[model samples]
Target chain A: MESLVLKDISITLGQNLVFDKLSLEFNKKVNTSIIGPGGSGKTTICKILNGDLKYNGSILINGIEIGESNNYLLEKYVGVVLNNSYNKNSLVIDELFAGLDTCNLDYEEEEKRVKKVVKYFKLQDILEKRISSFTIQKKYYIKIIKELIRGCAYIVLDDIFINMDLKEVKRIISYCKQENITIINITSEMEYVLETDNLVVLYNKNVAMVGSTIECLKEEKLLRRLGFNLPFLVDLSIQLGYYGLINKVIIDDRKMIDAIWK
Target chain B: MEIILQDIVCNSTKADKCLNKVNYTFKENSINFCSGLSGRLLRDLLTLKKQRESGYIFVNPNGRLSDIGYVGNNPLKEFTCKTVAEQMLYFKDNYHLKYNNVQEKIKSALLMVGLDESYLSRVITSLSTSELKKVSLACVLFYNPQVLIVDYFEKGLNYKDIEYFKKLFKKLKIKYNRNIIICSDNISNYLDILDEYVIFNNGVLEVKGTNKELYNNVIYKYIEEPHIIKFINLVRKKKGVELDNYIDIKELIKAIYRDVENK
Candidate 1:
């Protein structure tokens, strides 16, 4: 079943028409990353998904058209972490669970969930610390993945990788995959996006490309024109193929190393 | 223009020192990149401060001269000028530098950083991520300091903008003899432009050397071992081609094509 569906979506911000007839469907248990340039409406799409921004076209969740009736319902299902920094003074890590007390989930049950995610993110050392003292990047580290682990049906992250290290990014991606959380990560970094199950390329506020990872990588000219960096592994694989060193282009470094050794 | 740090240590509010007696000297009139993991305290060491420590940072140029600049991550917060033009002029007026035309200077700075001239009149709050970054860079460029300390150099720039900024840095160094100290987690992105690198791990200065030497060094085995470097190494081993240190894909392609042509 499709977890989220955006059909012929169009968004206009101020004098700019950000998205033009863009359409895409995200399936449950599949991690999807949206790749685009800086101002290519990737954030607009995420806003539409989170119901923060209104669009002209249709967005359906579980075959139910998204509108007033389902807006609040959708909030329970979708967890979002935007690109901007978050400032949460007078709040601590334990207080986060206390605030979620009104969400109807039992305190003990919520603690287990929070503890599980906190440990996963290696936040055990700073669990009692105030949110105000944490760095902008650390605030994101706790907020983004923790909310998703607390039973949000869909996860949406925008440019979270910009402030993150490679190990943290890899851990977050791996956690999203292990949890079977339907993730829609929007990033300008192609290397980070290539780790996703599917890729959506937005150019000039339109859906220029959409397909598997390799399919998007194969369209090097289009990717270049969109100002997206090609993944180094993909470039290496292509170079090897160009030099007749390898017959098949492999994106996984381990697989490529195995092929070369063989 | 060389910035030499000897026994530099910065402590946070809780008495936890982010930088622990770190020491290194960045080459003059050249790009020096510092890369490490996020939350690894690289930025703190670069700026010589923690989260709470915000005031003036002293940039020692060689042994005899030193200059001070306001130290803050968000440049927009540091500016109090009412208009964009006023802001550029304010920096010039206070610094006592004369430009041919204030408007032209602002326009050139915006264009050099890949921003449209139409944004000059717009409020600073109205700018996009990339635009805001360009404006910050413009402020730095306008100051034309002997030494520039940049944090997250390519944070919000697209691929084209990254290339543009790379070329802009080279031009700035050549034309104006400006020295840049860029702090980022991704070093390969600026390998072509950088003359030296200073690796910071856990607030301690681990290694400082040329780009090639750092690449060959085993301490940075993971971060510096980019695929391009591996591919270049592979070509050198397989075909005995002496590739340049800054061997990007385009350069690799040209080298391969040349080899084929000669054969």
Candidate 2:
């Protein structure tokens, strides 16, 4: 299986050392979420993974340093969906096909991949509409679709879902999982943490905690100390677990109800 | 002052109706949340930033354009000046408000928003996201508008910041008599603080309800129910246990403890 590894990475912005010798590993097809408070270098990590920032250590994907990876291979293996500003006058169709030629895929394969994602997202209705006409949430969806059309193996989502509706966010996440894309979501919102397979908590420019989502979440005190708003159910479960109202930390509302009433 | 939108219609850039003949009233000195399809359009109309295609909007008690204060998602983008003092002074100059002690008034405004006088000299860009948001609120409170619209209440905020803003909004409504309208599609964030919810679906007013009224209302059909509320409803439906509509997790936990112990 393809895996992404960050070995002893360090990034400094001017006088401040945002990250110092930070190390982490993420495997393919395992959706990992990195969460931290504001100014904790979450977005900086995204920039490093996308090869947009100059850092000290190497970022290896599939045992090869990302810096040495060919343009086509890099584009195919990694994609980033940041809330970056884009040209509003461009049409959705143009935005989708803007970087199609750069991908290693041939003409027919590229068109097929683009068509599949467009159809899945039901973008046929607004393909001709200017990006300026769509809402901020819709624009994010379009950006995600643009990345998905490239058939990216590892997609790093940089806090693009905070402003979106939760239901729609879950739907898109499930679709990405079906396509077996390794999702590295960096967010301040803890509610989306429950949807990921693994969790990475950043504090003081380093990894404070990292484990399976549920195992990492069980340490409520550390996460709280790290300045995260625990997901509602998680918080309630921990509270109830303390009171012996429920046996275990139940993340789902229905299961918690059953555990309580049983 | 109450904000009443009467047959208010807003069109998009393509001339399509974004807010279709919307009629709603945001009561004075209360906390209100507007969500759904045309929520942003409604925000623009309330601020008079976007001209309506048809109908009228009435801000009662002779409220003018300056009476409406809007703070969007990113408050840093709203700043034209560099320092906190300059932004406050710019508002004073732009509104032509004459004050006997302008410096003292600026300090007081900063304090009111939970910021100290030290922030006055700090550059706006140097402040953190939450600090910038508070500075933005301070700048808005300088004018002391009746209707204060905040877009995306819990986006960048942490748990403590969210709790802080909740108290601040309550203080704004109760002590200051300002109407707080938070424009966010996420209903979960406002469970503890929201007084009323006005949801729009497909460019039309879908439903308007108070706190308890939305516990089992049509709002859930469009938007997902908040986790606490969903659990409460599940207990009521599945186990035939009627738990109080407790917005606080602690209170709900206490109630559950009482019920489980009594059994």
Candidate 3:
């Protein structure tokens, strides 16, 4: 029942104020997505979560202050895979096991973890392939696998799904959910938000909206005003609602067609 | 300008060649979208940034090579200068363009890309990813080419920026009568604006057709169909209602409304 909480967070880069006195909470074991316009501080929040940037307020992971916690504690609680590129020369196997080398796990335990993750993801074939040889989707898969092996409770995906198809992204997210890992996805792609359990909308350097994924999406007007276009189905349902055809956001094609006909 | 490729074999050294004997034509003043993992390679080859392993590319209206402007995916890496003005100056010098007023030329190019004179002195390293992309695009616009090539519209760009670029590209195509070729892995990004679709998979040309043509063709087997297409298809198959294939959300909404009202 651990939760990731932020309180009175304020940060600025150079002359621009990115986030101002922002506060939010990510319920553990819940897959959450953060979305906003460009320069709206989505990446800044990811950096704060990973302890990569200096900020004014407190970030609490399972009631431990992130600022005071050591790297060991932070690593145990959170794992981050930013959208930035990985070293092209590194092999997949080496990338997967590099984090575990710091975990103090026994050699046998490390192998067991690596083997389980590789088998789970069906990544056994690409273990020897260099990162450069793999496609964008495969590279992200390797990064997620590496984090899975390290055994972090919460994994932050920073808009890495832009290049990946919706089906592929859903498969990976569903698998992570099955593994009982909290997935916090920071993204600009509104389509990916439909897959997460919770949704956080940031706008003008503050939290604009936060609620269950579908509920937040139902506020189509606010989403648009904040410089975000709702996903196709959601937008369709909203328009249909205006015409007195459908009542709620219908993401599935069959269900939506059924609603219109019914 | 029209670009025709004959038996194009690119990136031959790689296990999966980016293009395998691909024969395609990018029509004049048309929007072409090359979608797949090897899209970057295809774009590089089209822009002459990289040499093809083996191929015969025929660009109609000779001297089209100088007329093709390319904006790559990673804009930060596309620059070598310290500031925006310096970069623009270097491009002007490198291209050896005869600009009567260098300052006026720089200002106009930046303005075209939605930036202004204030951005000229800004350091390239300090600019945001979106700004860098704008600057990269400005560098290309400085040349005022007849054909424009842009790569990866979605990566590092937000919804607003993508929409802006989409509108800008459409203006360049329609108003200016310029040919545009966009290379992206996700076809959904340019589904509405694109006139033709050239899909590649593992360095092989899977299919090439107009948006409407490919919607009913076997293109679905290679790439994920847009949600609007999927919805339209479902309505056609299950409910026996034929809806026009509309990529734009607003148009699709209206079509759905009309269909529901008729029902």
Model 3 agreement with the true structure over B1-263: per-residue lDDT tens digits:
88898998876434334677888888988899876635456556766888987888888887644487878767776788999999988888777788899899889999887889988988886676667788889888887888888877567777777888889989988999888888776677788888998877767778888867747647778767777777788888998988887777788888878877776
DockQ of each: 0.34, 0.41, 0.55
For model 1, residues A80-191, the per-residue Cα lDDT tens digits are: 7776656666455665585465468876888887788777878777777887676556677767765665567788888787677677778887887778777788876767
> lDDT value for candidate 3?
0.80
Task: Provide fnat values for all models in the order shown.
Answer: 0.33, 0.48, 0.50
Interface RMSD of each: 4.7, 3.3, 2.3
lDDT of 1 at A85: 56
Give the chain A TM-score for each candidate. 0.91, 0.94, 0.94
**lDDT of each residue in A1-262, candidate 2, tens digit only:** 6898888999876456878999998999889999877667777887776767788987777888766546345666888886555447889888888757567677788778778877777789988999887677787888787787777788898888885767668778877888988889887678888889999988898999999998898898887776667888888888888888866677877888888878
Top TM-score prediction, candidate number: 3
> Where in model 2 is the C-alpha error above 4 Å?
A14-16, A68-76, A85-87, A99-101, B13-17, B37-47, B81-86, B99-135
Considering only N, C-alpha and C atoms within 3 Å, which residue pairs clash in candidate 1?
none
Question: What lDDT does each candidate get?
Answer: 0.68, 0.80, 0.80
TM-score of chain B of 1: 0.73
Q: Which candidate is the best by DockQ?
A: 3
In candidate 1 chain A, what residue range of length 10 has the lowest lDDT sum? A253-262
